[model samples]
Target: MERRRSSSCKMSLCKSASSSLGYVDSSMDVDCGSGWKYAPQVVLVKIYSFLNDTDRAIMARVCRNWSLAFEAGCLWRRRRFEMGGYRARTAEFQASGFAEKFGQHLRYLTISCNHPSLVTCKIFQRAMEAFLPKLQRRAKLKEFRFSRLEMDRYWRYEQLKEKLILTLTRFLRQQFCLRVLDLSYSQFYLSAGLRIIESVGLSCGHCLRRLIMEDIFHSRLTVYSGLRYKRAISRFTNLRTISLNYGYLSDDVMEILRGNLAGKLKTMRVRVYRSDPHGHRITKLAWNGLRRACPSLKVKFNFESIGFASDIIPILVAGIPLYELYIWTGFDDNSDWRLSSILNHVAVNFKDTLEICNFEFDNSTEMIDDALFRLTQSCVRLRSFITNAVLLISTIQNICELVEQRKLDPRTFHITACNLSDLEWAELAYLQEKYANMADERSIDFRLSSDLIVESRHAEF
Candidate 1:
């Protein structure tokens, strides 16, 4: 009898799992309150939310109610259209017609320029052109993102770039109130970048909140216009968050941001790239003034270097609160970086408020164990620690411990490129399963698998 009951219980759990996976469908329509076919609109919409975009698209074909729920305006507000290997190949996506259909519904829109086909396709271009008019009229659009656009050796590169900039400018000028705009890694010319920001500022001014315009591409001929930058940035009077490349930021720009009141400015992200020889021109005094004005403001600093961190780390770490830091360096052919320089200061100094820490190192470099320990142990608010460098087994364990202790708040420790042996992976899997059982028994909500994203096959198990 006990064995039969156990089998019944297992069957029920499997059914529950299947339900959550969201494949249940039947076409026998009934009255609004009769049965599953006639579930309330809210309930149906909520169920639709659980299914991913692909599944939702497939499910939409199941029934009229399901189709309506899938097309409900609420779900379409925040949209990200990118062509990855999966998305590009998916015939059912109808990505070509997305802009024409859902232009008015989009409050937050993110489109990737990294995909060659999506950006270059004539159908997509026409759709975008049609879409921009809808946004212009609606004026409800709040976020616009075009990320990972880089130059190449295509014959019509210059011609296409000019056309793209014109189209982008037209789109930007239409939106009157945008909260977030990301143009990072786009490698846009200074003039073109200025024009885009100027368009937003001319329209969006007071309503604009976060602007990410760093790592802008520069060439020998394209001039760097501080005046143009000042003109464009000063128009946005209520910016709460901003990310700008340090190479172009003059003292005037910093002063403009300070602007006597520091209106709504809470977060500042600065990227220091190695291409520019001048380094950062903002003085220690300007940093101090900004810190004094906005004591609660925290900085997310990304420093990219071929060798050690640029000399500006001292000036930066001195005044503002270092909330997050990412160091991407070639690590020089010289084997080791002494902790005293940047790592020790980061691990020891900003332990209280430092939440996100990431390091992208070249192949030859390995993170020192001591630094990882200090980072793991000290950072009480540390939410993320991601790296490409291969970490030691003990180091990985320390990160796991961090997550286990901070079970209430979700933390992420990701090793993106660590080539772990099968044996090592198996050991980690064992520990993972052990923790899973313990977490379940104790009713601890956070599990290590979701938070600790390592390359392991037994992750689901």
Candidate 2:
């Protein structure tokens, strides 16, 4: 009787297990619509990976949970505007809806239009009206950028179109949260645009941080005004990085920024386009502004026609915290030893914190070789170097030597040279072999491609 009872108990347990399996199988088709099948965090991550502006908008319709994902504050943190040729309404309609839904979440925004014309400005204004209210409600907008390159107009405008232009300009000036702004218009003169900027600078004093104005035609227009800059300095007490593209910045304007910054700035990059010797002098004056603004500084310089290298070394060495340097030397008509002298001077001083250096050359081979030798000796801890010029065999050897001496196990070096001699080819072959041997020990990459061909691949190092 006891044995029979044990058998019955085993049969009952088997039946219960079978019933559980059957229920699970039957419920396989059950919809997860109302259930917490996936966590909210997981859903949020999936929404973040949507490709384009349209994809981001479509995500709002996915599931009730996903619909709310677009409204999440994190999604609108950094807005990017790809302004293509006169800010089309189609683009604005799409972007503004997305921005209106999430603008309050924005912390950084980038705007790039195909053409930065009056029409583009109008479209931007329309989008802003749709989105800025929501952004203001959230009080989260922080940084904004306006980038454009003047190209041939696709649609011409009538000369009497002044009202539309004024309206668009007013919208930009009043859009409150544009704290840090970058204008790639490159044509900002000391005219109407400057006046608008100055007006905003004084009124919107609470938030602005950095203003970078680019590509002014200095020879044709003298637009840098001392009064405007001083006003800007007084208004935006938080202002840090202020850079001008052309060499038109007056000394007084430079001094205002320098005095206000007073040693808290990190990076100051200035590009001087004029070939005047005075232009190079202006570059130094800009650096001095940064130095005066901060007791110690980090600065980057790009000058197209630098006449005197000797004058720059003192200014550069003074910024002891200066690390990364990019110099574009077009031609060395006066001195062959200039590049060498500059590198040696830097190598002797800024050897500790410097990580990357990029140099572009339109100079003699001898001068290039001297520069390479000095670079290896100085920038020992450097991790990346980029150059488009044809580096000589000795220069290549110097780079390889630097790699060895610094014990920089893994380094990225980019060199673009189309035509190469037999010896150069041999050097490449040797470098390839060395790279192969160190494939697992370190990472080294090489690329040779045709202009029209596009291919993607991944290799395990």
Q: Scored by CA lDDT, what does every candidate get?
A: 0.62, 0.53
Model 2, span 141-241: residue lDDT tens: 46767555332232234232233234435545556766677765534334444554665575565567676765522234455544554565456555666
Worst 10 residues of 2 by lDDT: 452-461
lDDT of 1 by residue, 297-373 (tens): 88898777633644544545555578898887755646454432566667667777788888766534545666766
Separately for all candidates shown, the number of backbone clashes (residues 3 or more apart, or on different chains) is 0, 10
Candidate 2 clash pair list: 83-112, 83-113, 83-114, 84-114, 85-114, 186-214, 186-215, 262-293, 263-293, 263-294
RMSD of each: 11.0, 13.3
Question: Residue 447 of model 2: what lDDT?
Answer: 30
**Cα miss at 218, model 2 (Å)?**
7.7
Ten residues in sequence with the least summed lDDT for candidate 1: 6-15
TM-score of each: 0.67, 0.69
